[model samples]
Target chain A: MKKYKGYLIDLDGTMYKGTEKIEAASDFVKALAEKQIPYLFVTNNSSRTPEQVAEKLTEFDIPTTKDHIFTTSQATANFISGKKSNASVYVIGEEGIRDSIVEKGLQINDMNPEFVVIGIDREITYEKLSIACLAVRQGATFISTNGDIAIPTERGLLPGNGALTSVITVSTGVQPIFIGKPESIIMEQALKVVGTSLEDTLMVGDNYDTDIMAGMNTGLDTLLVHTGVTTVEMLQSIERKPTYTVGSLEEWIEKM
Target chain B: MKKYKGYLIDLDGTMYKGTEKIEAASDFVKALAEKQIPYLFVTNNSSRTPEQVAEKLTEFDIPTTKDHIFTTSQATANFISGKKSNASVYVIGEEGIRDSIVEKGLQINDMNPEFVVIGIDREITYEKLSIACLAVRQGATFISTNGDIAIPTERGLLPGNGALTSVITVSTGVQPIFIGKPESIIMEQALKVVGTSLEDTLMVGDNYDTDIMAGMNTGLDTLLVHTGVTTVEMLQSIERKPTYTVGSLEEWIEKM
Candidate 1:
């Protein structure tokens, strides 16, 4: 087995499932830490900040800090800042995305903006959607944190950011630049943050479509763990397989 | 021009534009009343009740009664009633759609509904959308009032019913049955209300896309009036033209 210098991990499914902690997750991180391998929790969750995510991971006995978290919100803000510093933006999201944009010194403007950014907003309203549509029609560059169609909860699968984003896309006839998983944008940003060469870094997650595809799209080797969404039976139908597949993160600890 | 036995007229673009009334609309409807011709106002607005719409038309000096108004809300309710009498429905709209559903003796159920219907809702919330999405995913038949992408307002073109509907459609990967203009559903309902045979009825309106296309789709002769949305220059680009083209409703008043 090839030794990886750094790791890009996925949350929700990989690190934990909803509010429940994955049994093998803590030990796997400990193994990586003992070897002094740097790893970042690359997540598509744009609702909560890194501090919040780190706190949750800490409760699960997983060694984590705010610096170890790299959410899609941060990637979206970074992408915008790379294009133009201090650009005016119309945002439709919660605290995480808003804070990230503000952290980058981007101006939040409702009337007229250079860009329109949308993230998962559980408090979403028709007025917010109307403002987004009007701005997009006025030639604002549209951007979404992620393209997650449905979010799993105790209640069942609910409409995700992708579903909400479709309102503006369908209305204004404008396609938004998605900055999260399965796209190279967030992966590239994560790679830069993790501070490792693509060849020496491994993308580890349980989702084939988002995490694995994101790694493949970014020219990084991927390890698919079966502890979450994608199962062994489900992966058999896929043509291109992940570089490594394991029943749990515990199985990969020996190799690491 | 061929004489028509009945007339199906559009409301917003044909009769009035926002708070302003069209100059030729009153004289045209008055001519229909004078000739004792049966004319029904067909509107895609699922927000306002037929009585409210009729009151507005009467205020504009157009001879209108609640009986002469046929809105998409009524059409949608009629459609649902035709499928299953007293069927439970999950509706996301204003008073118009809700009133029409109750008038049809249909039960409104948020949990485990037989049908999930969506109309234009200015007071739309994420919770309402989440309920609709959950219902649709749980095998409820999905229906939308209209597929008009944007609504013209004092502010600008705002997100329409179609845009709001996309959230569920995109999330659930299920296409909804649209019940408004450009679809034969609303036109068929309007024909029954107006007591008009498809061959002898004339569909009249200012918007070529909705009114004329609805007529064409329903096999009715269409008269496109250049008072609102569709202009003379715009009509030149369309390959399939309306049966009759007039500069204003006044031009057709003499023919009626």
Candidate 2:
């Protein structure tokens, strides 16, 4: 399309799931590569790193690197860095989240930190929770990667970092500055990275809440796929319908 | 206890699952029954009626009746009735949604409806969406039950009626009068039904976005159950922590 030069795509549900790649997804990427089209696999789930996501894509035979991936974690980190260039922080999270916070050259400490950056920490303990609440209540600007309370999986929906954010919110009565999907924060970053105009580019996602809304909110076209969290029936029933519906990434490429 | 004399509790995900009862959820009602507690079952899920929810509860061995139930459909109907007295409504919904529209003593027709009452209609048609959008754009007061974008199920998360409202919102830039949980619309009715003082009454549900927030928005003490849409981790991590946390309704009895 003459109107668009690049695309901003979502991972987890939009691309390969685990080691199993969706049919035509690889071929579509190959086509993009052959056509010299640029795309970034962005995700709101901040628990993983872009490197990790890229690795997963590589395993599925989709050639990728960290440069082609963007995450809510990254955006949050960038936002934090921009807002607080010299702030010390207490990180309630894992290596990925910790790295995101520390990557900005900001200090990470448990003792009287300037901010409490709450990310997805699987090993989160009561002490960490208490410390996070304390930090925020003490005026530390609490920020989170995304508000996805639960993540959908093949098994079922699992409580994501949104669950933790909820607890911290209740204790502090302060909502974290969210920097992920369906929010203007991450979309701005994606738009910058791809250098794609919103009108021409499309947001391909399986979730209506995050993906579709993100695109629609940013004035981009939206493509809904049934292979992820939401079904076509679900989309049809809703008052807000996406711009286009596809069965999978393969069908999406066919249309493209 | 000193202030409120009754209660109005939402049913879907709060009272029962697809066909199962929430833990100790019945005991709370039974305790109310023993103490001659006045409570009503209010729900935003228009998929069924008060009769169905009551029957499902009875099947689980918790006796309930139509008199003790109020649906958003019912609430919206009452709201419309109180406001317009008698006006024709362009109803975009199911049997429950339709019946509620009529309950307001309003005539239902697509010809020249003065207002548009939007609800979660499973068999949604493109024609309906267009009509509602047109009607709202034409200066009709648009009303919605809730803004819940997704509904969780055994299968997966489906686009809830809230998504419908979003579509209309984006198109018209007009927000509807939301009358469901977390909005303080129906929760007021629930309070009236239970005859419980706002100071002593407690709300327990599994969803943080609706059930718990509904209580938080109101002055009622809230207990977040971990059985349905929300989990233990979510309860622990939120910034808007509930008054109390329990793994299940059964665990709630232990608190008492």
Q: Taking the tens digit of each residue's C-alpha lDDT, what string does model 2 give over A1-256?
A: 3335677888767776644677657776776777777888878867777788788888777768898888887787788788878688888766677777777788888878877877766565545666676677678888888777554445334345665565566545677888788888899888888877777677878889999888888888887888777887787689978888888667656455
Give the least accurate 10-residue stretch of model 1 chain A, judged by summed lDDT. Answer: A12-21
| Every model's DockQ | 0.86, 0.02
> What TM-score, computed on C-alpha atoms, does each candidate reach?
0.98, 0.51
Ten contiguous residues minimizing lDDT sum, candidate 2 chain B: B1-10
- lDDT at A214, model 1: 99
Can you write out model 1's per-residue Cα lDDT over A1-256, one digit (the tens) per residue?
8999999999888889998889999999988888999999999999999999999999999999999999999999999999999999999999999999999999999988999999999999899998899999999999999999999988888999999999999999999999999999999999999999999999999999999999999999999999889999999999999999999899899998
TM-score of chain B of each: 0.99, 0.90
Prediction 2 TM-score vs. true: 0.51
lDDT: which candidate is best?
1
